[model samples]
Target: MIWTEINGKRGSIEIVSAIYIWIMKLPEAITHVTIYSDTCSGQNRNQYIAAFLLHLVHTHKTIKVIEQKYLESGNSFMEVDSMHSAIEKEKRFTEAYSIIDWKRIMQRARSNRHNKNVTPYNVTEFLYQDMIDVKALALMIIKNKTIAEDGETVHWFENKMSMI
Candidate 1:
């Protein structure tokens, strides 16, 4: 697992950057990944994020597949939220006025050592800005698209791509 603080509010750029950093640090043995993110259109649900996921599959031959999922807007009580709560609980007792402060708070959030590791993210290190226009590329390269019968969900897939 990987973690980090964003320079600003949680937006597409920040989310993409975080995911980019996390994937770059993943163990080479892992071949697949399923990312469950909140249904926030500005963040995970937009075309930009889809493009970022596609970029990952294109670049990393080891990762044969990557899936992105969104839970019902009001029904997100997954492991990620639990981890957020743990960090939030810790934040309540600390004075976090800078990026470093947040990192320290996250690092000290779990002292038990049994929880998944949390490493502070440096937003500057991952330059995802260059790929901001990936949404256009993704739209062009992804030709096979399927929509559920109900029309509530759509799926995109190929030899190394899948998203919903």
Candidate 2:
């Protein structure tokens, strides 16, 4: 799972706490996992606290925390930082303030619930796709009448077909 935070200045405690809770709730079989966060100095303390909590949990002989590091060059982190910089620039137009305002806006947006006008149907047409049923995809090889290939294995699903 990938998680990103653009407004790294605010809500550090809450975000880290939520992630810690989720990790603690996972099954004992998940012994190794990697956690990636941005290189924001403000989040360092919260991250330390979260790591301490995780250490406490591991002491009880559950899952072990494997790796925790900052995401430096990943696509998601790049996009998030780009947008964050853009928002910071825009906030400058409102007033000659530091990047803090932009950070606050991003935090508020992340924590807020989606508006009714922003329904999934309004954004995507995935509901109209004609796809294989669950039982068909579960088969090692699909044998659909529409497919002319002879005994071809289904490695990838097209956009029109949902993965089961």
| Candidate 2, poorest ten consecutive residues by summed lDDT | 119-128
State each model's CA lDDT, in order: 0.64, 0.41
Point out where model 1 deviates above 4 Å: 1-9, 113-164
TM per prediction: 0.65, 0.35
lDDT per residue as tens, model 2, 1-164 = 11234322234443454455567677878876665556554443232334344444446466544555555434445454665574455455455244454445444333324344432211111111222122222242333423435665432212111211
- Model 1: which ten-residue window has the lowest total lDDT? 155-164
Report the lDDT tens digits of candidate 1 across residue range 42-139: 77776567767877788786887888867766755787676678778889989987666777776667654535564442234333342244446557
Residue 56 of model 1 has an lDDT of 78
Q: 116 in model 1: Cα distance from truth in Å?
A: 14
User: Could you tell me the TM-score of candidate 2?
Assistant: 0.35
